[model samples]
Target: MTLFRAFFTLSRAAQRQLAFGAILACLAALANFGLLFLSGWLLAGAACAGLAGLAAQQAFNMVLPATGVRFFAMMRILARYGERLVTHDGALRIIGQLRVACYGRIAPQAPAILHAQRGGDLLARFVTDTDTAGQYYTDVLIPFIRACVCGIFFIAITAIFSFHCAITLAVALLLCIVIAGAIKARCATLSDRLSATQSRIQSELADTITAIGESLSLGASFHQQSVIMQCQAELSATKRHLAALENGASSLIAFCATLTALCILFFAVKDFQAHLLTLPEVPMLVLGGLAAFDVMSPLPTAQKTLAQVHRAFDRLEDACFSNTTAKSTSNDKAFSDYSSLQFENICFRYSGQEQDIFHHATLCVKQGERVAITGPSGCGKSSLISMLFGFYPLQSGRILLGGSDVHTRTPEDLAQVISVAGQDFHLFNGTVRDNLLFANPASTEEDMVAALHTVQLTDFLATAPNGLDSFVGDEGLQLSGGQAKRLSIAQALLRKTPWIILDEPTEGLDATTEQHLLEQLIAARPDATLLCMTHRAAVLPFMTRVLRIQDDAFCPSEEKKP
Candidate 1:
């Protein structure tokens, strides 16, 4: 089966729940039909009996019809209530399946794809798209199926009273269904076109919001605001168009339904006048005929929802299976400890860039060496770190860590040995211990505390009432910049990898603290190979070597005496 088709059968639990809910819906609908038809029959029979005579009224038995009406009324209410609960729960289960499936499909492609799109765009696929697909089961798929089953049963029940009447109802139902199907096809086409624009608008808005600080700082906030307003206007205009189309479709269906009911009533009344239909049975047939048409009431909404579901599915497919992600190279070889890391004849550039960032570049750090990489802004300091971790595919040459080529290594294997603390270190809205635990989940409290001490955060931990349990707030904003940086370092320390790459490690600290933090990092892993990408020339004394970013070549720096 194709990937999308496989999604339907991925979770048996959801399927079973959906089936159970559908059964309840069918029962509820049938019960409603029974209530309306029987109530009409009872009322008509009593009126006729009373007009006949006192003796005829006494002979009429109202007990069975009255009890049946009450039974069906109660059953209808209870069954409908249960059906809603079951269907929604089942829809939630389907959402769970989509969440997991999408995660699995997008994970491997994240690094490459994430850089190309805004976070909000991806969030829509993961959050909003799943919601739409789940509604497919509850609002569209389930209702459409229920309508079919009820329609068939309704016609069969009517056939018992009169074959000609049943056929008339069947023809009306079939015609209405064809109309619904046509609306659905058109809706799906429109939705597909709209979904792409919606995703783009969502991405643009998210990107703008995320970069609001930068935009304000650069004095470009007005431009960004104007762009956002434009997008919103376009979206609103598109929505109005969709509403107009839906309104037109609804009116057409309503017209068809009213015409069908009147025609059926006319035929029934004529048959009754001819004595072919009994007086008491005539009301039941008319009511049943109307109830049978109720089966088509959900058709318009079902068609529209199905169109929405298809739109969501298409967007999710684009997000997960997009061609933007570069092909990955996988290796199963175990990473062995090495005294040095080698970047040999490396040539690299960002995707779609004409110029190479690193052309025949080479770098080597000996075992247990402390090397500080100093470069001008936008000199690819962080890019080097990202490439080392296999976040970006190698354009040419190879990086050898512990004698094994990194390009040939699986990301899992690479991760086991190389640990990095990036410039924009993410602290993942969590507690002090929780963030640390992310680095080495198997580590105990003792290991965690020791790692924290290695980064010189022990005193801060002792001062807090929560200590290791201290809440860091969102993005560790509760802590000072230096403290957050130290916490990230501590998390990396918890990993205990031989190679530790720190991108701007001592950023956001005073002169004295910067030196102190550098000392602590050097002391934290005395035997581990440490590489620092920073602009702090004052911290060079602490490093075995300093390399400066230059115009022509990346060569050894003239260490400035602090």
Candidate 2:
């Protein structure tokens, strides 16, 4: 979708709040102009009256106009505060909604679509870039709206004193706007480049931090530091260039506003000489012109901000919605309770690869059956699991679950029916309960304990200071490899799905521990279908049927249990 359309859709939720905020901003601008104009007019009149002696001083009433000055001053302050509060709140609300929507879009296109992207780059785009996009509403859009509305109002007020002055002010404001637009156009390419550089810097920093230990061991920490410093220097140089352009724009805009005020003063003096304008009206008109420029002063900054916002939206759009293979499937479709899985005539290959991982591969697993799939390293075992989860699109194949196409099921539906515990599983840096609840939010303490017991983590849970609430350090770094893997298994088991897929489930465990885990894992999910991909023979006897990949297709293995 176009950026405009995307922005519109994402901002619809906060439109009411933003619209109200815009109105308040306009009010604030008008009040500020009123304060300046009334103060100038009132002070000029008072000075003139005092110079004209007692009679004129008596004729000039300062009480009402002074009161008007105080009123406008107060109004300006309150309105400005209200405007900021409402607009920022609305902007924050829109940003929060956008983040959620962005995550929802990107979540489905896992390893395949996101493999090339660095974690930090993706994070910067999702969080930082998306937040920058929100500034378009508050910084660019609102300011532009206030400038236009208040600009017209100021010009109308000026026309009451001198038509020439009003026309001059209008032309100057229009010129400033035109110049700001030019700046925006010029900054577009620069902003895009800056955004890319920033993302790269984040990626580099993240990689360095994540591998700090390895870098230190290899005596390469200084190299990574140098690289980061180089990126930082490039970023600083780009920002400096952008700032120069912004500062130049602001200087030119201020010059135009000052020149416009002088021209208005010249017109006002001529009208005063012609008796068309009074002395008090001269200062009022000149100061009013300056106040009007205040409304437009933010235009240059807004225009410059627009360039960055555009880049942010473009990055968010690409990261969130691009290259997704999700299909429009009916969520209402009924999924059978005792469904069989069928992979028929499957053909698959990764992008930029010469060989097919699977070619005309067919496999069938009946309900409640234990199926084992074995293949050499670098074969398609893990890829097959990814396919089952719709993480990658098949070149030519259909995976059926319960007589329905696997592709036809929603992500939520698929998650409800199948759970996979793979090697190299990630555990979030949160409490153990938090991780388990993430898999199944409805799971209770009893359910979690049972799953933990099945994975042979009962002893650790008992010894953990906070039991289920015990924190798992980053990626479960606090736990041993076996404990981490078992915890992940417990998390998967908490899903209580009809089918569970295990990929090298016991790869790092000893034979005795692996055997015990396999036994308990099967016993815990007695009626659930099990699909395991393994190189180890210890798990083979538990499988009702065994299949091996030969020439890119599954064949009945000779080791299958009779």
Q: Which pairs of residues collide in model 2? A: none
Candidate 1 positional error at 211, Å: 4.5
> Top lDDT: which candidate number?
2
Local distance difference test values of all predictions, in order:
0.80, 0.87
RMSD of 2: 1.7
- Output the lDDT of residue 371, model 2: 91
Residue pairs whose backbone atoms clash in candidate 1:
none
* CA lDDT, candidate 2, residue 158: 85
Worst 10 residues of 1 by lDDT: 323-332
